[model samples]
Target: MRITAAVLEQIDTQTVPHRITLEQIELDDPRDDEVLVRVISCGVCGTDRGCLHGVEPYPTPGVLGHEAAGVVEAVGRNVTRVHNGDRVMIGFPFCGRCYRCLRGEQRYCEKNRDLTFSGYRLDGSGGMRRRNGEELAGRFFQQSSWATHTVALEQQLARVPDSIELEMAGPYGCSISTGAGTVLNELRPEPGTSLAVFGAGNVGLAAVMAARLTSVEHIIVIDKVPERLALARELGATHTFHASSDTVEEIKELTRHRLDYAIEATNGANLVADAVAALGMRGTCAVVGGSSPSAKVTLKHADLLGHGKRLIGVMGGGGQTPAFLESLMALQGQGRFPLEKLVRFYDFADVNRAIDDSDAGITIKPILRMPA
Candidate 1:
C-alpha cells in the first residue's frame, strides 16, 4: 500500500538542521504474525528528538514514532489478538520467548534493542520501502507509527475501550506508562512517605499524578519551567520547585532529610544527582530519562554505600503492556490521572512544529493527528 510518512532525511548540522519531510512511500503487507493499522494519532517523545539530533542513531529515511494509537485495518492469518475496526495502541516490542518475557517481564525483553532500534525486523526484512525500491527503516518499536499506516506485531497491540478517546491513548505506550509504572510498579512507596520527582515533563508529571493516587504524603515536583511546576501542582503535586543550585537543599529541608523516594525524569539534563542528593537513608531513586546512547552517569561510592541510597533504571515503566495501559486508561477515565491537561494536538503535517514545541518545553505532550 502507498502511504504518507514523515521521513527524517538528515540530522541537524551547522548548515542543514533538523530536516524532516512528508513523502509518499510504499508499505508492505502485514506478515503472518502482524497486523496492519491505520494510525489515528501518535505522540512525540524525547526519544524522537534524540534520534533527530543524532543523540540516538536510526537509519536515514526512517519513520520515528513509537507511541501510537490507531484502528486495526487488517490482520494476518496468524494474528488473533486484534481484528479489523478494533481500536488499539502500539506498545513496546518484545520477544515473547525471552526469559524475562517468560517470567512476565516483557519490558526487559532480550531483543528489545534490535526490535526497537535496529530498523529492520528480527529476520532482517522490514515492511517499508520507497516506490523506487529503496528500503526505509520503518519498524521502529515494531510499529514506526509516524506514517499514516503501519504494520505491528500482534503482541504489541493494546485495545482501548470505547470510553477512551484514541488521541488520549497513544502516550500510554511509552512516556506516560513509563512514569506511572515507575511509581505503581517499581517504587510502590509506602503510606506517609515522601517522593520528589525532578523535571516536570510528561513522565515526571505522570509520576506526580500517580503519586497522588498513592498514600504518599508529599509529592514534590521540580522543574525550571514555572508553568510546568504550576501545572504539576494542579495535577496533585503537594509541592513544586524551580530547579536551581539550592533545589536539592530545599528538597532535603522539605523532607527533613528523610525523603522516601525520588524520580529523575529529565531529557538527559543529568538531574539524577540532584534526585539522589535529596534522598534519605535507604531511599530509592528511579531514573527514567532519555539520553544519548553514549551518555553515562557518575555516582559517589560513599554517598550510595554509606546512606544505603539505591539508584535504579526503569525502561518502558518496568511492567507488562496492554494491562498496564488499560489500568492507566481506567484511571484517566475516572478523572484521576488527568493526562489530558498536558496534551496538545497537532496536525500530522505539523509534526516538525510539534517536535520543536516539545524541545522548547512549550508542550508537555504533543499528539499528532493523522489525516483520514
Candidate 2:
C-alpha cells in the first residue's frame, strides 16, 4: 500500500543540517505475526530528536516515530490480540523468547537495541521503501509510526480505552510511561518519603504527576526553565527549584540531607551526579533520561559506596504491560492524571515545526495528528 510518511533523509549536524521530508512511500503487507494500523496521532519524543540531530544511531532514509496511537486496520492470520477498528497504542517491542521477557521484564529484552534502532526487522526485511523501490529503514521500535500507516508486531500494542482520546494515548508508549512507571512500578516509594525530580521536561513532569498519586510527602522539581518548573508545581510538585550550581545544595537543605528518592530525567544534561548527590543514606536514584550513546556520568565514590546510595537505570519505566497502560488511561479518564495539560497538537504536515517547537521548549509534548 502507498502511504505518506515523514522520512529522515540524513542525520543533522552543525556543518551539514538535514530536515525530515514528507514523501509517498510503499508499505508492505502485515506478516503472520504483525498487524496494520492507521495512525491517528504520534508523539515527538526525545529519542526521535536525538536521532534527527545525530545524537543517536539510526540509519538514514528511515521513519522515526515510536509513540503512536491509532485504530487497527488489519491483522495477520496469527494475530488475535486485536481486530480491525480496535483502538491501540504501540509500545516497545521485545522478543518474547528472551530470558528477561520470560521474567516479565520485556523492557530489557535481549534484542531491544536491534528491535528499536536497527531499522529493519530481525530477519533483515523492511516494511517500507521509496517510491522507486529503494529500501528505507522503517521498523523503528517495530512501528515507525511517523507515517500515516504502520505494520507492527501484534504483541507490541496495548488497547486504548474508549474513554480516552486517541491523541492523548501515544505518549503512554514511551515518555509518559517511562516517568510514571519508574515511580509506580519500580520505586514504589514508601509513605511520607521525599522525592526530587531533575529536569522538568515531559518525562520529569510526568514523574511529578505520578508522584502526586503516591503518598510521597514532598515532590521537588528542578529545571532551568521557569515555565516548566511552574507547570511542575501545578502537576503536584510540592517544591520547584531553578537549575543552578547550588540546586543540589538546595535539595540537600530542603530534605535535611535525607532525601529519600530522586529521579534524573534530564535529556542528556548529565545530571546523574547531582541526582546522586541529593540523596540521603541508602537513597535510590532512578536515571531515565536519553543520552548520546557515548555519553557517560561521573559520581563521587563516597556518595555512592559510603552512603550506600543506589543509582539505577530504568528503560521505558521498567516493565510496561498492557494492563499498566490501561491503568494510566483509566487515571486520565478519572481526571486524576491530567496528561492533556502537557500536550499540544499539530497537523502532520507541520512535522518540522512541531519538532522545532519541542526543541525550543515552546511545547511540552507535541503530538502530530495525521490527515483523515
TM-score of each: 0.98, 0.99
Measured over all alpha carbons after superposition, the RMSD of each candidate to the real structure, in angstroms, is: 1.0, 0.8
CA lDDT scores, all candidates in order = 0.91, 0.93
Model 1 Cα lDDT, one tens digit per residue, 1-372: 999999888878777787888989999999889999999999998888888888887888788999999999999999987889999999998889989999999999999999988888999998888889889899989889998999999998888877779878999999999999999999999999999999899999989889999999999999999999999999999999899999989998989999999999998897888889899999999989876657777877876999999999999888887788888888888888898999999999999999999999989999999998
Residue 125, model 2, lDDT: 92
lDDT of 1: 0.91
In angstroms, give how far residue 44 of model 1 lies from its true place: 0.5
Which pairs of residues collide in candidate 2?
none
lDDT of 2 by residue, 258-285 (tens): 9999999998897888999999999999
10 residues in a row with least lDDT, candidate 1: 290-299
The clash count for each model shown is 0, 0
Q: List where candidate 2 sits over 4 angstroms from the true fold.
A: none
